[model samples]
Target chain A: MIAGSALYQTAVELNRRAAICIPEDARLAVGQLCQRETHSLSRYVLEQIMENYQVAVAEQRPMCADTGLPRFYAKVGNEAVVEGGMVGLEEAVRRATAEATAAIPIRPNRVHPLSRKDQNNNVGVHAPTVDYSFEPGVNWLELTVVHKGGLFGGDYRMLFPADGVAGLKRFLLDSISEFFRRGMSCQPLVVGVGIGGTKDVCVRLAKEAACLRIVGDRNPDPDIATLEEELLELGNSTGFGVMGLPGDGAILDVHIEIAYTHTGGMPIAIQHFCFAHRRATARIGADNSIEYRGNPCWFTPFYRRESISFQPA
Target chain B: MNNLEDLKLREVRLRAPLTEDDIRSLEIGDVVFLDGVLFTGREGLYSQLFDLNLQPPVDIRSLSNVTFHCSPAVNELRPGEYHIPAVSATASFRFDKYIPLLFERYDVRVIIGKGGMQKEIYQSTFRKYGAVYLTTVGYGLGALYGRGIRSVKDVHWKEELGLAQAMWVLEVENLGPFLVECNAQGRSLFEMANAEINQRFEKLYAGLPQPKLKRLGEVTSPTCEVL
Candidate 1:
């Protein structure tokens, strides 16, 4: 029998992962405004996030007080297996997640959107999206995990039209603009542009796009890269000030997952991932090929708050 | 919060341009019950206006001491209905897009939102044109209601964004428990909150290995600050 110790350690790591986030500077700005200020309106929502952080800590409460439906992304190596790793990976994650949550005092934020009753953050039919990209010969439990707790679950959208005339930039701009007009706040305004693929595949592809590893950076493809740049610029210009800042706001990264799309049309839909992007993504590689990029880098991230005694003047 | 019976509200059409003479004379706290017509455009409208290099949909010259914000009307509105309330939806951020334009093209004054604003916009627009931004309750939709018959006018990007409708209404007694942060002057608590989230993100990511350092207070962003 695979001893349960492996499960315990993994859970601890996941808990640590829960409290951390790595939103890039640009993307961070957008998230703040998108949360309350709306998208397309401001350039400096990240500033508001600093103030909000103070509120979350001073209150000693969950940020936004809306702990989200837990979503974990665990990347594992092909050769490196947990010693006595017999209990299925899914079970290990589920079990570990439950225990770690308790240890960290993570808020019981999972609630039925309709019923308004807390679910105590447990997995029902499909609570966590366990995504795995297999590495050939890596060993050791090395993974990066990040989750967005306060946000509402983001929706999954596919923006590819059958006619195929509307360019990617047009679709993305239209999608984001519409999201802001809805008048909702703190809702993660992430656009998962699934290109290529046929029918369902396109949507599935789009869903994958929503979980980009690099957050908001350019895509590898040249055509997609251009569109990404244009949309990013247009999104900030919407004058929708994020977190309520006036003009130009930081937006969470825009991700695009492209497959071989059908020739019929270009259909791009916008999916609003909950209030905070509480989904965590980490990799457990035995070979250690993937390393943290930035200085003082580690696979882990942190959360911040400040003294309320000193207010911004 | 007096009922409409006690409040002074009636509709008035724009016969000529409203000058500073109109805005300066109004009392500071007395609720200005506006009738006649106003645009119901939100973000898309803002984007379109930005594209056109203009202010809002209303005839600018005729707008003085006018309020600009996004609001959705609850309760069905018929052609000649007497009762309906236009509740403020999202406090807009696009005011920057049109604030200067409003002051320049029309001596329009007054905007609305759920929080305070930056000083420059306030001074540049309000100080110059006697305009000020009003902060309304962020989620007090039910609190604002009165009756007026109206419907949507033109929608720019109507295909994706629905009707950029127009509705006329009477806002009642508690126009809002909107946070005190909102006023014409300029200062955004929202900006501070955004900055806080960014800094904490750095600290949280850095301290992941040392999980013992985790404190719920440090782990999450705060909920209330606006007094």
Candidate 2:
């Protein structure tokens, strides 16, 4: 079994560190998307991105909007057991959420779906945007941060009338093209395509797909993997490159996750995660020793980004 | 974003028994060059410091230091901008309570941050306690790098929230040249758009509820024991 308190502490420290480090590249890409002027300090998208970042930064908090529909993907082996052999994801997420909450000081961004009301921190009986559960394995506890911040500008239900796979592909490609041709002020957007029976699964899966890839990585499927390459070419062909370069290779590194379903109807779920994908951690050892990897950079930019004025409160 | 090499910042510690030069010389746009031993203590840290009633892990009262109004970053990715390992959870509201006490007990010179203080902080603390609050653009790294900050004075803010141990390197330069935000003074481009939409919203709605703050880092907690 792994240590608890102390181990949790160190991990918390690293999580924070990662959040700090990860958001910069994402912000820079925003600059590229907006095609910021080279010398105009205030005119560039970087300034607006920075302005957005500062709100999060000065507040000394996270900038990610969706915070993802979180699901703690885990694997608790036989080695780790609860006091009287009681165990589960509820216990894991609760314990882990508590440790992370204290360590990351994560603002309670969670909310209830039905009421559209915020839970703040109480993770009450109501469901959350994040779903943390179990995986049978061992090693005390190891956690990963996966968030698909909702930047739909509206709701996920707003879809283009699903007409199965063939028609749906047209709908999907068009949206990707619109995002690219229009020149996104937000870039390095992780696009996840979820294909399966139900809409919720595909949508949830799509958001989760973003977490599947590391910052500088790609997708894992073969057939859809080919589609990813094609989508990548189409997006890059639009002349929207890394950071919005006319010559950038790919506008998006697309990832597709799929599950089998009946032949009658096909549902596609698409989730767009901002480039500022953020995550935090806390590792505790058996000795009550804690190493906290709180928020990292690159998650939400703060320092000298392109600035934008705010509306009067 | 300028390269890390391009960004320059200076760090200095704080001291008490205010001198005329320290008080008068400080103004709206002057850049500071500081270096020496200083420590961090917002409300939380301040309480801890008062309770501890001794030189804690870090040194305070040493004029040899400058306290940044902005949060310290973990590392530098570029000039003016750096990798902030943790989000420094400092809200002026929280620290205002302890500033007077901090100045009274310790020698603090420069405080760096956005919207430092109003007449209340200045009249009571700056004038009475021989202290002044400096405004580093409301929210951005440009101010940190503006004028010219060279580097960290030493290991600092090791105890505050948001990546306590991560190193934040500050640089100095022309921040105004790099960023211009939509602020109270009505400078941000965003304000223009938001205002237009708001006008329409106001007409269509009444008795609207206030918008709440949204943030990330909400759920990094371990996944549930079961799905």
Candidate 3:
């Protein structure tokens, strides 16, 4: 059986891994861009970001100080048995978050919205938010932890059905430009676009796309995939290279996820994931042994040449 | 495409208790590697410095040269002993209101942060106090941390504002390779970049087909180049 204590330990381990590790894919993308960039300042910025990634990973320190809000995506099997009920599981995760905040020593970034008060620990109401999905006939638990709390980048908009594809392109470009003007959301950024859903659904999808999809992944639908590529090219052309400097590539990738929407309205959310791209996934087997990997594989049916490191505990 | 091919950048080394001449010698587009005592503070600390009118725990004139606009990730071992693990620059314009006051009251000759500041504030601060704005690398926390930071000398309001927002006193050696965004002469690289980029954006936006605005939602257009 999967014990609540084991789940707690898993959460802490996931947080630690997410803080320290910059996936090999992001490094490769930045490294490749550095070679192509002609602007001395842009190249220098990319080099510096790369160096930071390497040092942080080796030292097991956070790649960025804004070790953002801890968010988790969990896939639970209906067939799985737990040592304690769902409430017990939530309590374990919360305890683990406090432990990781101290152990990984991430800055306490949470505060009460109304009172403007901070606990000096990265815990608050509905924080370290978890999105759950149940899979039938499987007896394993899959949890993916994403560091989405960074204040660097995020924006959303709802459009009339008449806005169409051109609307998406315009809105997205404008949003990226606005973010660039406001000091940028720490580039080379991963852009996620959610189209054709309700406001909440599109925003959530965009966040998932930003935090979950690996760089270089494409949408399964050909038309959506084309839009993603077009947006990526356009965003990169903004000349807001690394740190709003000048460079060839501003965006690392653009992932678009879509769903059916009202005939009169189309909601689009444009979410930016900074270069940190910190995430980790773990699977707790029915036997209670945990296996871990770097990415959550949210956008499957895509290609990734980089290998995922699986550690068993 | 504002060809920076001919951008001549001066290389400089700055020490704390910087003088008017030291600030004057700098120009927009110059590069500086700073040496001396540096301190960290951000939005929360800015309120303490300006709104509250409360004195900082450390004598401002004693450190007296550079103040970084950042809230670093720190690990506190005890009451005073702390380990700075990661630090990155934040947007400067967020605290533009307090910046001029910082230069006026304190002997701060240079302010370090990322994403540059508004032209009016930079020009005013420079004209009045000969203070300059230097931009450190953004999103490169490890590189910033790797600089010759000696130790955390003191901290103010850790209990109230939390570690990131708390004011910190630090001693540094050759602590930067900062890009000069604004100089003591009141020239700003950010303003220059904006003008050039805006012109390019204008051209780019013009190339796109104009849409007919028939409804409230569709009418929202990209306001040109004024980030």
Candidate 4:
């Protein structure tokens, strides 16, 4: 059985890693963007961003003070056993979040929506939301911590089938125009588009696409991959760069995730993962051996399977 | 595309409690680094000082003339002592209403934050007070900015306002890479950038069809800013 203590320890370390380290994929993408960025002002901003990333890791401090909202994604092996079951696992995560908040000194960003009461520990009702998915076979549990800024760069709309790709492109442009001006969304962003599904599902997918996926990863489906490329090109073609300054590129990449939805509606949600791009992941084996990596590897084929039954090859 | 070596931006380093001439000398797009002192403030401090009309516990002007829209990631090593590991600016547009009072009451000459206030506010409040707005580079250079902070001189209203919203008096040196978004003369670099970007929107959106359903509060004009 995987001990609760191990889970707690791993969770705390993941939070620290997420806070201080700019993942390699994101760092490389920014470095490449810096080279390609043409505008003098935007290029300077990109260079500063890269310098900030290096300083964060070297100083062992958070890359951004807004540590955003710290949250988790867990992928469980079907046969994995935990010391305290699901409740035990959740308790460990909650406890770890509070501990990491104090130790890493991440801003305690959580509070009561109405009363605005802060516990001063980044722990509160439904704070540090933990989302779970399962794999067909395996005996390890993987966790990914993402600290995404809560304000700006997210939107949802219901489009009819008649609206088609043209309408989708318009919606993408609308969201960009709304937030990209004045650099409200903090550009050189990863644009995540979630298409088809219930409203909530699409929103969740958009956030996952933005936060969970690495810089160069693409959807396995050919059609979706093509759309991702098209959107990436379109988003960068806007002549907006970092801080909405006139430049060659604003978007780092576009990730699209789809789910089956009602026949009449083609619901869509979009989320922007900013230049900060903080996320980290780890896997805990049944033997309690832990291995950390940059990519979350969240979208397993089984998780996206259309078939009712999942088979492990 | 210009070569990286060919592009050069004018960079300046200024000390706090700046004079009218100091503020006036700055122009839009000038990169700046700050020294001396600045304090952190946001909605909580604004609501208390402006909305509730509470007198500052300490004389506001005595602390510094520069104010930052930020909350650092702080650790209280012991009671009454703190360590800040990182600092970054929050979006300033949301606090636009308080700018006039801040300039009038506190004699604030420099406002540093993420993004910036609406363009008209620059022409009105900022121009009236001979103030300028500087935006943090990348808007998330928390560690780089944090390194500049020498000490947390004082913290106000931690119990009442919570850590993130409390008034933090910080002493900083070389604390920036901030870009002048709005100059003393009221010209906004972002507004100028927006004007150029907006000119391309029509062509970019030409081939795309309008949405099937329109939202009530959405801004339809490509040129109009949502803020």
Candidate 5:
């Protein structure tokens, strides 16, 4: 049986790393995007983002000031053994969140939804929210933590299935345009679109797509991948550039995650993540051994494709 | 389209109790670099400072004429001392209610944040108080902490508000490269950017043919969880 103490240790370690450094893959993608800036203002802003990452690494500071909301996605093995079961895992998360809040000193973002009371420890009602799935044969638990800063934006819509390809495109474009105009989402933006699932499933998938997927990677299905490509092109065409200045590098990538839904309704969720996209993944074996993986590989063993061109319309 | 090249730029040295002439000289799109003291605070601290009628722990008028909206991530080195670990800009629209009140009571000549503030504040309090709004590069928080800030002075509200929400008196040097968003003359950079995007959207919408949707089957009510 895995010790309860081991779980808390793992959670603290994961939170610590996710907060302090931008993932290696994100660094590579941002570097490539910076090289494509044609406008002087866009170039300046993009370069600063890169420089910020370097400083975060060098000084061991959080990559962004907004440490954001702490979210966990886990896949637990059905056969896995734990000293206290899943409840123990939940308690472990709470303890770990508190530890990290004091240690890493993440912003205490949790507050009473109505009373506006600050917990001051990043733990409150339904906080450090957890989503998990069970795999029957697996013997180890894998966890991915996504730190979504407060500035990120998202929405959900239950569209009539008849609202064909045109409706989908219109909805997506309209949302992006509104955010672009308001300068809501930070640029070198990452857009995550979820389609065809129940409303709850769609929203989670969208967040997963936004935070878990690598910047330059694509879905294995050619059709879904093509949609991602088109959206990326359309998004950049807005010329929102970096921090709402006019330029070409408005969006760095678009990710689409799909699930089968009831024919009666097509639920869609659009989630936005800033360029930081801070996340970390770790695996805990039945014997209590922990392995911290570099790349999240959340949905691995997928087909690889050539990188799409980002030419603005 | 707004052109950055045509924007008038000025380099101003920051100090407390700025003259009316200094505030008025700045206009929308002007670039500024600060060279003096500044302080940091965010939503919660604003509530405590103004709504709760708490007196500032330090002498506010002695510092520069600027205040930044940042709830920094800090690490405590000793029992009371701390070091800034990260810094980032936050939105100012929600703080609209208290900003004017702040200007009326204090000598704050310039406000800094990301995504700018509302237009009413700019047209009214900013113009009336002879103040200006500045936008820092949002993604450059780490670089800002490293290059811009020199040290953190005495911190206020650390006990109740926690580290992020606590008001910090910071000594800084060359802490800017802030874009003038709202100026004393009442021009707003955000308005120009918004208008430009709207104009461009009109063309984009007109050129594209609307996509039609076809219903495949029956309707089912969805049960969505609270996200």
Candidate 6:
């Protein structure tokens, strides 16, 4: 059984990693963008961003002061068992979040929405939310933490089936036009598109698509993957570059995620993962050995299975 | 990697408590780094000073004429000692209503933050005060900016406003790579970029059709900004 202590320790470490380190996948993408960028001003901005990444790692400081809203994604194995079950694991994560806030010295951004009262620990009612998905044939628990800025760059809309792919493209363009101006969304970033499901689920999938996946990974479905490539091309063709300056491209990659929804409505959501792009993942084995990794491997075949039943591949 | 020094963008450095000439000399799109002291402020400080009519805990004009819209990743190392590892600007557009108060009451000459305010603010308030706005690059270069901070000059209202919302005065050496988003002449770099960007919007939207249904208060014009 995985001890709660191990969970707590790993959670703290995940927070620190997410706070200080820009994952290699994101780093490489930005590095390449900086090198190929043609516009002098946008290229200069990208260069400074690259330098900031180096300084953050060298000095062991948060890449972004906003630190956004810190949250977690947990993938649980069918055979995994913990010392106190799911509740204990949650407790461990919550305790670790508060501890890491003060220790890593990340700004305690969470506050009471109406009262605006701050606990100064980044923990409060429904703060630092944890989302979960399950997989079969393993006994390890995998956790990924994402620190995403919330003020801008996410929108949802309902479209009829008749609207189709053109409508989807239009919506993506609209979001880009809305938030990408003045670098409000902080461009040269990833764009995540969620194609279906209930409104909330669609938004959630969009966020997960943006935050959970590694830079280069694509959806396994061929048609959806093609859509991802098309949207990416369309997004980059906007002539919007870093800080909303005109240049080669603003988007690093486009990710599309989908789920079955009501027959009449084709709801969609768009989320932008900015250059800060801070996230980290780890897998805790049944033996309690923690292995850190850049990729979260969130969208398993089982997780996206369409049939009523799920089977291990 | 390309050498940043080779870039053609004009760069300038200025010390704080700037004079009218110091502010007016800046041009839109010029890169800037700042020296001397600056303080952090946002809605909390704004409402306190403007709404609550609370006198500033310290003398504002004497401290510095520069204020940053930011909150640092800081920790109290000892009873009154603090350490900040990273600092980045917050979006300044939300505090638009307080700009006049800051300029008139505090005589603030320099504002540094992320993004920037609407063009109207620059034309009216900023132009009148002879102040310029500098926008932090990457909008998240917390570590790079943090390195320029020489010391924590003071902190106020920690208990009342909480750490994130409290007023933090910092002494900085070369604190930025901020771009001049809004200059004293009331020109805005973002507005200039938008004019060029908006020209391409028509072609991008030409093949796509409007949605069958629209939400209330939806912006129909592709070229219109929602800000």
Candidate 5 residue lDDT tens string, A1-313: 7778888999998988888778887877777878887866667667878888887777777777677889787778768888798899988988998889778867677777787677777888999898886655668888778888755468777776777555667666666655554356776767888897798988988888888888888987899889899888877776567776666757768899887889888788888888766788888999999998776666543212223532222
What lDDT would candidate 6 get against the real structure? 0.90
The local distance difference test score of model 3 is 0.75
The worst-scoring run of ten residues by lDDT in candidate 1 chain A lies at: A296-305
CAPRI quality level assigned to candidate 4 from its DockQ score:
medium
- Evaluated against the true structure, the overall lDDT of model 4 is 0.90
TM-score of chain B of 3: 0.86
**Which pairs clash inside model 3?**
A69-A149
| Per-chain TM-score, chain A, candidate 1 | 0.67
Model 4 lDDT per residue over B67-177, tens place? 999999999999999999999899999999999999998899899999988988998999988899999888878999999999999999899899999999999899898
What is candidate 1's lDDT per residue for A5-117, written digit by digit as tens?
Answer: 54446555544433333234323534445455432223222333343333333432223222234555444444676544534666766666565444443434444455434
User: What fraction of the native alpha-carbon contacts across the interface, defined at 8 angstroms, is recovered by model 6?
Assistant: 0.78
Candidates' interface RMSDs, in order?
Answer: 18.6, 16.1, 2.8, 2.2, 6.7, 2.4
State the DockQ, from 0 to 1, for candidate 4. 0.68
* Model 6 segments more than 4 A misplaced: B1-8
In model 3, the runs with Cα more than 4 Å from the true position are A149-152, A299-313, B8-11, B140-143, B207-227
Model 3 TM-score (2 dp): 0.91
Once superposed on the true structure, which residue ranges of model 4 sit more than 4 Å away at CA?
B1-8
TM-score of candidate 5 on Cα atoms, chains taken together: 0.87
Task: Please write out the lDDT profile of model 3 over residues A1-313, one tens digit for every residue.
Answer: 8898889999999888888788877889878888888877678767778888888877777887776788788878779877786777777777888888877877778878776587777788997677876665679888888876455577777777777877777777777667765346887878888887788989888888888888888877898898899988877776666765555667889999987889988888889888877888899999999998656765443221123542222
Clashing residue pairs in candidate 6 (N, C-alpha, C atoms within 3 angstroms)? none
> Can you write out model 3's per-residue Cα lDDT over B190-213, one digit (the tens) per residue?
666556455555544654534443
lDDT for A186 (candidate 5): 72
Worst 10 residues of 2 chain A by lDDT: A295-304
lDDT on C-alpha atoms for all candidate structures:
0.40, 0.40, 0.75, 0.90, 0.74, 0.90
Pick the DockQ winner: 4
lDDT of 1 by residue, B70-115 (tens): 5342222354432322333344554566667655654555555534
